[model samples]
Target: MTFFTFVTRGLTRRPVRTGLTIVGIAIGIAAVVGLVGISRGFETSWQTGMKSRGTDIVVSNMGRGLTPKPFSATVVERITPLPHVAETCALLVDLISVEKADMMIVSARQWGGFSWKNLKIVSGRLPNDAAERAVVLGKTAAEVLGKKVGDTLQLETEELAVVGIVDGGAVVEDGSVILSLPLLQEITGNQGKINIVDLRVTPRTTKEELTRLCAQITGLVPEARAVIAGDHIRDSQAYRMISAMSWGTSLLAVLVGVLGVMNTMLMTVFERTQEICVLLAIGWKRSRIVRMVLWESALLGFLGGVGGVLIGVVGVQLLVTTPAIRGLLEPELNPQFLVMAVAIAVVVGVVSGVYPAWRSSRLTPSHALHG
Candidate 1:
């Protein structure tokens, strides 16, 4: 029989054990891919959303750590007149429970600004009074909540009227509840508190001008920081931390799979002791025996890798389709990610088989035959 055929036969000798080992490896790969995929999807969605709205920069309070701090509304006025700045708006962001759903709702407001023009109201109308208890629902939020124009929704202890429904096409806005600044302040009980400020620069603004403007804005409010929204979202410490946590968990899962592979390989070595001895006595070199064992382990890993990719893809799909996660993320299967997963599996297989293969090769013909 050919070398490959021999390895295949060996694996088939215990079909149940082989299948379980492949499954163990697959679960590890799936966990890594699914978790990291969700984080990446959130990042991509946020970046694209801000870019689509022509938002040039964002200003916010520099919190103690990676979390964003809420600052006073006066910060917006301080930034409005900066050089190269054409317009500015502030937002109050909060997470509130909705009575109609089991998930937390992202509630936001445009604090003190000219009529915000980026979003289009497809039905109903925006709040006429800043302090009025009215809500403008994003398209997705309206659909998910099953609320329509003039419908009353309970938030906190207050009954608010849904004044409008809007479509921004950006997942962040489309999935959020928006209200006027004053109304949001009343509900959140943080009067004059705002979390973010969006800035739009003049068309002819140069890079130097933008930098100078940011510096001036920072000078105006030393507690706040000015950042290009795109760069900040992509390279922020918070983003890195989340990605690291995902991979950290993935590493643990990978180790578990590696152990499973090693145990399986060791078992294989024990089961084939007499066969190895026969081969050695018949003049098959020690290196050939090692190669045979390594090939078998690699073949198992290859099958495991294939199974892992399939499971990972399905897991990502389920996460993206779930109502709570669907609004904020759009999980995509990256070709590069798949290739990396497969490569990891192959490496795991090779590494796991190394000690077993060495031990198998070192066994004397007499000892292996007696065993």
Candidate 2:
């Protein structure tokens, strides 16, 4: 029989143990893929949402929390008149229990700002003006809260009319509760307060010019920082937290898989001693015997990796559809992640098999045969 076939048959000989080992590794890999994918997706979705709305720079008081702390809405006026700044808008972003949603994103944008233009009304109409005591619902938010045009919804203690259902184009935007800045402020008791400012630069602004402009903005507003939109999430405290947690959990899962693979390989080495001795007696070199053991473990890892990718993809897909996470962010699945996972699995297999391979290679044919 061929070398590859021989390696595979040895794995197949004890199907139950091999299957369990593969499954253990697969579960670990799936956790890594799913958690990492969602965290990345969350960051990407916010970045894309801002980009779609033509925001070139984000001005906020980003701190240790996931949400930037509220600041005076007047910051937008100071920023708009600055050089290279063509347009600007301020937003009050908050998380609150809204109707059926225990927690939801509430985005209240400055009246008549470009930020409002991101939503395309599929039905109904936007609030007449900043003080209209009305609201527009994102299409997904409408579905979740079971609201439609002309329905009245409660905001804190104030009741507001829902005048429109909008398609926000991005997942995070569509899942949000959007309203005028003035009304939300009145209801939430955050009068004249805002958390974020979006800015768009004039045409043909060079990269160096943009950097200077950011410095200028921060210089103008001592309490706030201006970050280019592209690097927004990379610098956010919240994104860093999300990434750290995702990777930390994934590391634990991978460690479990490493131990499992090592155990399976060591057991196989013990059980296959006599078979290895027979091969050595028949002129199979010690190196060849070691190669066979290593190949067997590597095969197990490869199979586990394939299974893991599928499970991870499916798990994330299902998870994002659940109400708790729905419309929050699109799961970011990259081709590179799949390739990396498979490669890591193969490496894990080879590493796990090293001691087993060494032990097999050290066994003299006569000693193993007699033992």
lDDT leader: 2
* Tens digits of lDDT, candidate 1, 211-236: 77877887788877887877655545
Writing each residue's lDDT as its tens digit, candidate 2 over 235-352 gives 7787899899998998788778778888988888888888888888888999998899899889888888888889999999999877777767888889998778777777888888
Misplaced by over 4 Å in model 1 are: 62-67, 102-107, 111-116, 204-220, 234-241, 283-285, 365-371
Clash number for model 1?
0
Cand. 2 Cα-lDDT: 0.86
- Consecutive 10-residue window with the lowest summed lDDT within model 2: 362-371
* Each model's lDDT: 0.78, 0.86
